[model samples]
Target: MKIKKLIQALPAFVMLTSTGVLANNGYVNFPYPTVISATPSANTQTLSSTEYWEVVRGDELKTGVAISFTGNKSVVLLSPQYSHDMNGQKRAPAVAENAIELHTLQGKASLSATYNRDEMSGYGFAPGSAAVQANKLAGQNATLRLNQKISDDDLYLLHVKESDSPYQLNVESNVMVQEEAALVLHADVTGAKNIKPKLAIQVSAPDGQSIPYHFTNDKLAFDAPLEHVGAREGMYNVVVHSHSMVNGLEVKRSVRLPFVHQRESASVITYSLSEQTAKHVTANVSLNVSQEGRYGVVATLMGYRDGKQIALATSEAAQDFSTSETLPIRFTLPKGATGPYQVNILELKDQTRLQRFVQNELVTQ
Candidate 1:
């Protein structure tokens, strides 16, 4: 983006009057200035001059003073400068800085700036443009402005307006869970009554599969059910699409909603290990099966040194558990010698069922 630059000779009688003043001796400068467009009814106010400068398309600006523009199509170009300190008998020229501060009381603006140092440094909104301290302005109206400190070689562009989008949509819930055999989603929208609104919902699973649903009504409020039996124990993306006719043309907007399905196993199991001795370690395991079933228990003893597994031992058994019944099982690691070892007890039903109990312990012998 090209920025409009304002450059002019400094009049000797010009004085600074704006609140944006550097601590030392500094002033703003305009170089290669150009006015793109402005309305005849627009006006500008400067600190040094009480008279407002009339808005024009090609008017040249004289100093780097703080100015406020009002009315339609009001625009100008400007930059800032600071005086250089003198050393011994030699006097150095003032250094030019690209730090600019802007505040909009009741308008919108778009700003773009190029930074010689870091590209991200030139794009912030603040109240003042000076390098030193500055004051902040307050107002209820929304304002679009840019505050940045740039080198004299960098360029920037700023455009301001006073308008808002004609339509807006807001969702009350971004995340929902499938509960009690059904998943329900809801949303609220505004500024869409006259446009004949339409709603569409799409669900995307983890395996790159998508299911789409379109609503029949144009109501701003929505409550819909998403039925999918295959969605289980993972995250799914629920996208809501809103379409409407604006000025006899169709406009569409979409938002991604978060949906999750979490189903836990029917049983719970816990285990603890006895203190290790020179010859073996013993683990005490407990299981509370909520559902009656035959469950398999596996205990694995593994030795680790320097964070890598060195040796392994396995023991397995099966038992029938009644509903709400507690079962206690014990396993012994028989490897005679060890430095650090881990014991893991896992209980499950066949290979297809989720693990009902998973417990581990670290011990030293």
Candidate 2:
């Protein structure tokens, strides 16, 4: 039910603007339903009643003619009479004229172009060539102007194109995401190998505002504002860190962030240990395994003497354990021992489980 209300409210919700106009400094993010205005209601669908545009004297260039529409309604530029392309062109500049046109529903539409007159000003046009000024002059509120005399072709083109300017947001692609582990501060810790790692991402907005995002399993995403970290069109730093335990001893691993714009994903790795076995006397030796995903654990002890089988004991534990906890395990040595003995520890690699154990060597006195 809430979703329905949100969906229904989307249109008006999008039209809401932060400030009257966008910030002048380069990029400014505006929410949905970017409002566009033109003289004729035909130009701006949002306008009520009839809006008319006239080239009283000099060429009158329209403002906010660029058309963009989000999801539902599309922006339509309706020119009663004009037949040209984006540039100042006409099927008959001497007769029929052309104007700028667009079809997007949302986003800012800039309207401005260099003027031309009869191949004399090195501006004017032929039969079907057109060009609109792409940007606005700083501090000059976008408004119509009649600076010079315009032919019927130029006049008609202005009305036709300016009426319904349709523009589009062409999002090419996002560069690969990258993550890095926190700075390491240990002396004996080493990195793990041959395993996929997990990475945490932090996102911030241009104003330092922070937000949260979710990614699929084994994946992490941060869609918050860039300001979270002093946002702007500059280098933003992302980091990832991982921790686990082996044989009651903790282990850690990490990696640096993405260096290339095309790369963005990374993870930290852990170790694995197999089943353990001891000989002669009972002794607790530490074993370590690396890996954090789903895994299984198994432990066993066997005794052997002079190429002959002897008495033995076994122990096992299975479930889910992360690298963060120390697995305290205890075992007893072989009985009726009179000669040298050996203990063996074996780990089954085919099972779908992460396991690690510590190995210790001891003798009977």
Those runs of model 2 whose alpha carbons end farther than 4 Å from true positions after fitting are 1-287, 293-300, 304-311, 318-320, 324-329, 332-335, 338-341, 348-365
Local distance difference test, per candidate? 0.36, 0.29
TM-score of each: 0.27, 0.17
Q: What's the lDDT of the predicted structure labeled candidate 2?
A: 0.29
Root-mean-square deviation of every model: 27.4, 27.7
Per-residue CA lDDT of candidate 2, range 1-365, in tens? 64598799776634542322332222112222321111111110111111112222113333223211211221112222355656754433332123443322233345444432222222223344444433422212123322223443344323212111121111111122323221111111122233233333444432334446664543344544222111113333333333333332222222223211111111112222233444323323232334443222223333454556553444322223344332222334444433233333332111222112222222121
Candidate 1 clashes: the total is: 10
Identify the leading candidate in terms of lDDT. 1
TM-score, structure 2 vs. true: 0.17
Report backbone clashes per prediction: 10, 66
lDDT for residue 164 in candidate 1, whole number 0-100: 30
